[model samples]
Target chain A: MTDELDRDLLLEFAKAEQPLKSKEFTTNVMRETQILGNRKKRSLWLYGLVLLALCILFAGPLVKLGTMFAIGFISPLVSFENPWLATLTMPVNNIASIVVAMLIGGRFIWKKASQ
Target chain B: MNNYQETSEAGIINLARTGDPRAFEELVHRRQSIIRNLMRRLCNDVTLAEDLAQQVFLKVWQSIAQLSRVNAFDGWLKRIAINTWLQYLRKNDAMRNSLEFNDTVYVPPPGSNGSVAMDLDKALLVLPEQVRTCVVLAYHEGMSHPEISEAIELPLGTVKSHINRGAKKVTEMLAAYKQPTAGEKV
Candidate 1:
């Protein structure tokens, strides 16, 4: 029967010797793992240091400077009552309209060129 | 000269999870032979198989912490090995894409003098990669079709067909070596 044939053949295959083990296999694997582990540890330390630096920066004069810039940037958009706010909003709006116009023109030209 | 031999696999896995190189090394030493054998059969290139086996162990070392079941270590290791082999095949798409049939000849042992198992091993190398992998897993590894499907990430139908086809080929190749019965002469 076909089953018998398959069984016999498979049995023969199963008798094969296991692939010969390399003498240095374990040593090489260990060495690589150690190197990988060290790299991971160093990366973690670097991340920690960057986080600490960011915390220190945010706690210092950087926070005040950032807050001042944010308020100045947002004040014109939220309300343009002061002359300085009008000045800031005018240039920003003009630049924004110019960029939007350029984008639309570029898209039309690109579509024509592509076609 | 290492004390690693005294430790259990679970103990070693714990150490490896904690990034202990010696413990991982011990784990490698214990399991490398089976993994290498499986790789050798799957790839049919001893050097490539060895390299892939090393990669499998490296993966195990790197991702041991992600394994949810400690007792499923063998299955986990096999899954990693199979995935690594599949990835290699995927990257070298040309190997699978080629229409060329493997033409390696299977020379049967002369007059039953040599080991049939040795001949079978050589014959196995001649099979197409997918078929050989299915046959080896089903027979040598004692895996069922469904298990092989999941492990190899092949469809169940394809796995079944590959096993059937592979078994038939092996049987045909080894038919000459089949022993004669009482009425038949060798």
Candidate 2:
């Protein structure tokens, strides 16, 4: 239902009129870009350093946890056990070992499958 | 840059892709007007338009490396501009669910062609932001519905309806001006 008059009016308004142009516009954009660039550089360095520090700080706990899990996993495979415990407390020891092995194995499979 | 002064837009884009600030600044200078004008009309606010323009350029600079085709620069830049404005509109919750055909009558100057355009500009400000965008892009920028849908990230049907409703509203509003005032000398 649009008429010629409406079309003409819109075209007239559409004609480019740069009333807002100023040298400051370009300068402001460039300045903002410069500030952002500097901020990005600083943030990248900070993030990298923070990540490295976190890994270093957690290395001991992470290694200890991994070793504990690895021992549980290996005990099932190796079947190495103290002779005295095997004789006197064989059932309880076996149950504890089985529980540990299942927990560790399930966790390892979940992590690997997710990755 | 003096070296980049006569370079084509594609050449400048390539340089900007590689982190040349001068080239990016040059790109901004070249495309600033169209982007600013589109934003100004879309927002109907000069200050917001300028702010949006800056954001569009900043986004373009940030994502310049992703633009594999140099010829798609205009389309890409416009999409960013439209998206930025749409985002602003969304954040403000300003999209009107229904078009309000305001009763303010435009009294066009007698025998003057420019008055129609001037009054139309004023009339445009009263439109809902989404319709105003579609109207401006369709009539002013001469964009097709598919192009507009792609740029605005709206469905094609939605773009068509907005353009139709917007144009109808504007035409209806302007229809009032064509009638002679009661006391005017014939």
Candidate 3:
């Protein structure tokens, strides 16, 4: 019976609470939401720019990777071998070779003019 | 109620699910006090309660898009509130003080001071956190043991034990306040 009374007392006390009044409560929460939303958008844009920059910076290695995979489909035996020596012997064998040669030629010409 | 105020919570939640800030603001305006009060009861500190309440709403905003049951927002919000408190406990002290309940030591919480909120805070802060949460949700929020279990992700048996012992401890602590004053009762 005592336990019952105590439980009832607690319930009544809690239920009788008037709502906490604060003029700025909702405003503060909304301000935070807006701030977080803007941060999320900003970070998304930053991530996109970073990803694009990374792709550009490593375009040469990426193209070579794509070429190696493409060769696996065209001639299935390339996947089975480790033939790094073939690239030295046959430097202009594919599209990957042409891009690398063009890049190297452009850099040499640019550096020579700057000198 | 004005026509705008009469907008059903379901309608507001549906609009919020589409990432509309106005609808979300309507949600905050409507439920902030209830959430804040619940946090205050759970945490026993006014500032922490308000901050946690804001965090709960922010989480709701972030993930409400994925909330499949629009009508179950109350339970969803309660779940988030419970999670926020539990996470705070995890980071701050890992709830290591849970085992330190001194049953024999009694510190009288003075008179009721005409503020049951203050007394409730004192009464609750006496118990360890797990017990305090169960007792608060069970008695204060009127949630069932199973509901408390699901919200706190504890087993049903553990929830029942906490509420049982926690309620007993809280009642024992507050018995002084419950006593009638001189000339108040025969």
TM-score-best of 2 and 3: 3
lDDT of 3: 0.76
Ranking by TM-score: 3, 2, 1
* lDDT, model 1: 0.74
RMSD of each: 8.6, 7.1, 12.1
In angstroms, give how far residue A6 of model 2 lies from its true place. Answer: 6.6
The DockQ-derived docking category for candidate 1 is acceptable
Of 2 and 3, which scores higher on lDDT? 3
The TM-score of predicted model 1 comes to: 0.68
Superposition error at B163 for model 2 (Å): 2.0
- Each model's fraction of native contacts: 0.56, 0.29, 0.34
Better of 1 and 3 by lDDT: 3
Interface quality of candidate 3 as DockQ: 0.19
What are the per-residue Cα lDDT tens digits for candidate 3 across A8-108? 65665566465876447878888999999999999999999999999999989999998887784344222324467554445455556666679999999
Model number with the top lDDT: 3
Query: Compared with the true structure, what per-residue lDDT tens digits does model 1 show for residues B86-178?
Result: 888778773365322354556554456556545565667667777787788887767888888887778989888878877777777666545
